[model samples]
Target: MAGSLGPGSGWTAAVRRLLRQFSSAQRPGSPGFQGLPLLVEGQQVGLVVPAVARELRAFPNVFVEVTGGLELRGGHCPEERTEAVAGVLAQLRAEGRLARLARWRDEAYEVRPSFGAPALLNVERAAAPLLGVLQFGAHLNAFVCRQDDETGSWQIFMWLARRSPHKATYPGLLDNLAAGGISAGLGVKETMVKESWEEARVPPKLAAQAQPVGCLSFTYEEMDGEEFGAVVRECLFIFDLEVPEDFTPQVGDGEAQEFYLWPLNKVREAVNSGSFKPNCALVVVDFLFRHGLLHPDHEPLYPELMAVMHQTL
Candidate 1:
C-alpha cells in the first residue's frame, strides 16, 4: 500500500486550504469560561463563552468564510433548526439566568432518572435516548507519514467490523480492498461496499473505491438504567477505512457536519486539554499516543494520560 502511493499522492492544497479557515479559528471551549445554557426547543442546549455570547449578540447565526465556509457556529450547526434555535436561545437568555452556552457534545453525561425513566443527560442538563442499536464504530487516526524527499502527513486507514444498514453497519463482510492492506496489506477479498448510497447519495463507485478504516463509534445508554439504576457496560467499536485525501463527503451520510484536519501538534494539544468531543480524548488520543503520534514535547504535557495509555493499551 505504501509503495503504490507515489510522489504527489495525497490531499490537495485546495482541501488543506478549505479545512484551515475553520480549524484555525475555532479552538474548543475555554477552560476558564463557564458554560452558560441557552434554552432550545424543549430546553435542548448549546454553549457560548461570555466573550462569544457578547460577540453573538451582534451577528446572525451563520456566515461565509474566506475559504471553505457557510459557517454555522456559536450554538448552531447548519443541520440544527435555525429559527427555532435562535428563538429558544433568545428566550433562555431572557428567562433563565444567562446560561454559559451549554454544548451538546457527544460525551460527558450523567445517567439517572428524575421521573422514573432512563435518560442521558449531558453537562448542559439536556436529555436524549439510550438503549439503542448502532451499525458500528469508525476510527480516524492521523499520522505523520514520510517518504524520502517528501515528508508529509497521512491519516492511515485502520479497520472495520461487519453488520448491515437494513440490519446494521456492514452486513456480513470482510477482506475488502479498503482495509485489508493496512492491517496486512493483502488486497481485496470478499468485502462489503459503502453505505454512502443508502445514507447520503455518494456514488457507489466512491464507496467501493473508498477504503474503510478504523472505528467510527456509535454509543448510547439504555433509559432503563436511569430508572432502574442498572449498570450497563460501556460499549464501543473501532472501524478502519481509507478515502482519497481530497474526498469530500457526500450528503448521504447522516453526518451533515464538516471535518478539517489541523496540524498534528494543534490537534494533539486541543484533544488533550480543551473540551473537545469527550470520546476523542477517551479513545483517539490514547490510540495515537500508543501508536507514537505525540511528539516528545507533547508527552510531557499530558504525562499522566500518556502514562496511563502506555500502560493500559
Candidate 2:
C-alpha cells in the first residue's frame, strides 16, 4: 500500500485510506512494482510513487507512464490521485525534494502539448528581432579557439556573440538564457547552438561543439520614461561556443563584425567604451575570466562596460 510518513492532511488521509482499500484488493502473491517520477507540463511540478502501471497513468503530468512502476521519480498526480497521494508529496516537500507542489491548471493544452517550440522562437526573435527581415534569421556567435603552445589547452575560440543592433526583439520578456517572456521558451545549451546555425548558415559540423557554459541576462527598460532612446527594449540570450583550434567561424550575410580572436582585454575595452553592447560581452567575458583561461593581469577592458551591465538591471 502507498503509505506516507507522518499523518496526512484531509485529502491525503482520504487517498491513503483508498490505497489501503486498493492494496487489499490486489492479490497478495502478485509481483511488486517499483515507483517512478511524474512530470507535469503546464506547471513545473513532479512527484514519485510506486504502483501498478494503470494507477500512475491516471496522472495529468505523466507523458509516458511506464508499464511497471518506477521509483517515484517526479511530478504531481491526478486530482483524483492527489487527495490520495498528497501525504507522500507533503512529506517530501518538507524535506526539500518536492518543493514546487501544484495542481494542474490547464488541461486542454496538456491534452495536445507543445514541444517547447515557442521557447526556440522566442530566443531567436529576442536575440535578433529583424532576424526574419533577412531571407534567413540567424542569432550569431563568434567563437575564437586557440591551442596553448605551453599548457596545451585546446578549447573554444570566442564564445561571445555580437550585441544585436536590431532595436526591438519581439519576445520582449526573455530576460536571460532561461526565464523567457513568451508563453513558453527554450532553455538549454544545444538549442542555442542550433539557433546560431539556423540564423547564420553556420555549417552543422562547425557548430557541433557549441556548449552552454552559462547564461547572462541583460534587460533594457530605459525606454520606460520620456522619449527618444528611452523607448527601446531587448533581451540577449548568451551562449558559449567551444570548438577545436582549427575551427573557423562561418558568418552569413551582414551578420558578424570583424571575426577574429581579439584579446579578451581588447574585447573588454570595447565593451567599457560603449563600442560594444554589454549584454553578451559582459556575460561571456566574466565567464571566461572566471575559468582561469584569462591572465590575472588582464585589466578592465571596458570600464563603461560595468555601467552597461548595471544599467540593464
Candidate 3:
C-alpha cells in the first residue's frame, strides 16, 4: 500500500483536494466572508452567517444581536436555552426560511463550548450546522484480517456501506461501516453501537469490541441554493472494529442498502475516485495513515494531510 501511494501516485492530487474541501472554512479576517459568533451564556458556541442572522433577528426574544455576534436568549439552564432555541428553529422551518431545515431529524445535539464541557444547550441536529455549533459523531472502520498465503503477511479488508437511496442527505453515497451523530445524552461508544446495529446488523456484543481511536474535525461552509447557509463545525470520534473473517454484516435498519468487503487497495481506490462521502473519505485516509498504508517517507504531503484532517474547531 505504501509503495503504491508514493509521491508520483495519480491519486495523490485527488486525496489532497478532498481533504481541502472539508477544511475549506474561511479563516478569520478573510475578505468577503464573515460569520458572527453565536454565544450562549457568554460562551461562544457557534457562528451564524449574515443571512441566517437576519432571519434570526425576526425572533428578537430568542436571538439577541450583540456588538460582534449573535446570542441565544433565555434562562441560563440548558433545558431553557434548548426550548427557547428549538421553538424559534421550528418556526423557521415552518416558514421555509432555511432549506436544510426541511430534513429535520427531531434528534437533539448538545451544544458545548468544547467537547466534554457541560452542555450549553441541546439543539436539533438539523439546526446544529445552521447555528454553526460544534457537532460530534462516531465512525467505525470495521475490517477483517487474513493471512496472505504467498507473502506470509497479514492483509486487511474493510467493510464499506452504500447508504440507502431514501436517505435525506448524501443518498446512495458510500460511507464508513457505521457512523452516526452523537445525539444529546449518548456517549461515543453508545452511539457507535447504535449506528453499527442500525446501519449494519452488527450485534451489540460484536460492536462492543470496537476500540476508541482518535478523531477528525473540520469547519466548512454549507450553502443552500438560496442565501441561507451554515458554517458546519464537526468532530467525528473514530473507532476500529476488527471482525471475524466469516462475519458478513447484514442490513439492519435500512440506513444502508448493502455492504462490500473490499481489500485495502480497493478501498483506497474508491476514496481516491471520490466515491466515499467527503468526511468518510477523510476517515479512511486516517485509517490508511494508522495502518501504514500512507507514510511520511513516501507521500510528499504527509505532514500537511495529517495537520489538515485534525484541524482545531
Best by TM-score: 3
Instruction: Point out where model 1 deviates above 4 Å.
Output: 1-232, 273-275, 295-313
Taken over the whole model, the C-alpha lDDT of each candidate is 0.31, 0.33, 0.88
Worst 10 residues of 3 by lDDT: 1-10
Ranking by lDDT: 3, 2, 1
Which candidate achieves the best lDDT against the true structure?
3
Q: Which digits, one per residue and each the tens of the lDDT, describe model 2 over residues 62-169?
A: 235444322223334444333333444344334543212222122111111122222111112221111110011112345555666877755443433342344233
Error of 1 at 61 (Å): 50
The TM-score of predicted model 1 comes to 0.32
- Summarize candidate 3's per-residue lDDT along 1-313 as a digit string, tens digits: 2233454345787767876787677856778668999888888999888898999999999888998899888767888988898888989999898998999998999999999799988989998888899999999999988887787777788999999999998889899999999999999999999999988989989999999989998888888976888998989999999999888999988999999999888888887777888889889999989988887778877888887788888
Candidate 1 residue-wise lDDT at 56:
37
Runs in model 2 with CA error above 4 Å?
1-191, 228-237, 293-313
> Backbone clash tally for model 2?
35
